[model samples]
Target: MKKLILLLLVFPFFVIAQDLPTVYPFISEGAKYIDREASIALEINILERDISTGNIDSNLLDFGLEVFEYYNKYGAISEDVYFEYLEQSEYGDSWLSCIVPDYVSSTLKSQGNNSYNKSNLGDRDPRTAWVEGADGYGIGEYIEMRVYAEALKDLRILNGYQKSIKSWKDNSRVKSFKVYINNVPVRILELEDRMGEQIISFDDLLPEGFDIWSAEDFEIKLEILAVYPGERWKDVCISGISFFGCYC
Candidate 1:
């Protein structure tokens, strides 16, 4: 009985190991990317086309791509990008501006987190809506990731500019915002939602190496939860993404 139980317990491990593929070792450098600009957003495309196994695991289609800022020679800053919140219109229509064409198709639905399970990390539960929506009745779902740049300057954010975010006024919830310089935590400015076009003030000051007189650090990362409430999930569509900064 003891040996039988042991075999049963180890059997699943073998099964899982068999289920996982070793052919496509994770290519970390190629998988990771950086965009140095005033405002930059990234999109990651995940698919289950394992050339080794003719089978595809649609459930493993979701993954997180982290962003970071480097400072000096030994410091780094990073954060997990999260879904922001959205509100319905006063007339009960889903706020359309918050909806982008890139994520507006029935082919896919947003997966909540890295697990690719139905659970959402933040308030909004992104959809795992059927790949075919309700039309096909029982087909699976697909999803894509999208990020948007919120500014038109040098990708720099000032503490004073966050004052326009509407969520700041509500003391009831913890607004998600973070920043770092050379791995050191920096203060993030909270603002009202209406301050969308506001720019951070540096007074012509850049980081130490940038200009001898510059006081603010030039290489820094500011992270904020961009989507929330309605859902962290995004529908997929084909179109060019628009941002407020120059693209390389």
Candidate 2:
């Protein structure tokens, strides 16, 4: 009876280990990806097509090429690439302009000495966040932040805490999300669970470029379309969110 109980306890782990994809061994030096899981995933993702690459996220695809190129002895492109965030060009990184008041009407006050709050979002710290404990799958939760830049070009969102591996998976996080620019519907994207970080490009991508920065109250709103529940907490959280654009 004890032996049967032990087998039952360990069976799931044994099955999970087998069910996991084969982690192909490869090395990279050019693009030091933030998430090791994403690095290995990228290796499997690109190599599956005979190293020819295919329809994948452009940033990930670029990182793969950088690693491939570096491995194949390409130019001196040291630290020129990363998969976790977009390498902003033409202008410096965008700043946290301001948040539209009505959307973030209810601010979650800090608990004890723990410093996770809405204000931390603009502090430029991925370790901090504003979380809501509504119990539901984070639907109806949203943020409308002003993109205060000379030319608001793009938006980037980093879902969940990415300061550490344990913290990331320990809290509920966004899965599918929606975007609104200047109160106008823009796009919807399904985020990658392996420490999601995605950039939405508007220049040349949107019809007539959807330039809303010139508008009086230019705001970018993100709503929780769906969520992935945490292991120990029901609260939905976002580690970091950024705006990339021209200061000029």
Candidate 3:
């Protein structure tokens, strides 16, 4: 009997120890939830006093609550508040929060300048492809890429292949490239014109109803394609890239 009881206690500890690290704790607590069909509403508000002056006190803004509504097993309705956090604002005369439309719209366009390029490749260099680099190499460099305040923004390639080439025999052409945004893969432009600069604008390709990122933190990734031989990817050059927008 003692052994059985001990096994139960030890088992629980082992399970918790293994699962604890993977489970992200909630900043604020309420009812537990699953991603069932439900509605999530986020809001932000600014006090009139804070906007009266041209300068805004970041301390005076309210971030608001994250709410979720769903139905219980018995068909009963339920609503809960999940987490609490303070929203940040720009230094301006008017106060603003994430809930406002203007704050969300600002992220729609390219904001500032940030660039990424593949280093020059020598005649017979193996590191000519788009693998993560050391000294802040390409892949797995950061868990998340973001732009906040007066800092460099992360730039992502639109796709792996911008165009198709028939000169090479079959699959000899560079098929894809990789870029990371906020530690996640978001865009991938296929093979295109390799000689001249090709521009990619993300606003045109973003998913419908996907609101512009209002928070200071966001994640995205990009992939570019490279071919071998005369058109070896090593010969290509990515001058630079950038991002711009107000993060609410």
State TM-scores per candidate. Answer: 0.21, 0.54, 0.28
The total number of steric clashes, by the backbone 3 Å criterion, in model 2 comes to 0
Question: What Cα-based lDDT does every candidate model obtain?
Answer: 0.25, 0.55, 0.28
Q: lDDT per residue, candidate 3, 110-133, as tens digits?
A: 215411223211111111111222
* Superior by TM-score: candidate 2 or candidate 3: 2
Model 1 residue 46 CA deviation (Å) reads 41
lDDT of 2 at 196: 42
Instruction: Indicate which candidate wins on lDDT.
Output: 2
Q: Least lDDT summed over 10 consecutive residues: which range in candidate 2?
A: 20-29
Runs in model 2 lying further than 4 Å from the true structure: 1-109, 204-209, 213-217
lDDT of 1 by residue, 90-191 (tens): 122111122232222243244464222212211122221122222332122222223332222222211111212222222111122333334333434342
Off by over 4 Å in 3: 1-145, 148-175, 178-184, 223-237, 244-248
lDDT (C-alpha) at residue 132 in model 1: 22
Model 1 whole-model lDDT (C-alpha atoms): 0.25
Candidate ranking (TM-score, best to worst): 2, 3, 1
Candidate 2, residues 1-248, lDDT tens digits: the string is: 99999999999866753342211111222322256445545644444443343444454543444545553464322332322122321223344332322345244556797666676555444556778645465687787776544666655666676655677777778776666556555455566565645565556223355546665546666667778887876677776666556655
Deviation in angstroms for 182 in model 1?
A: 2.5
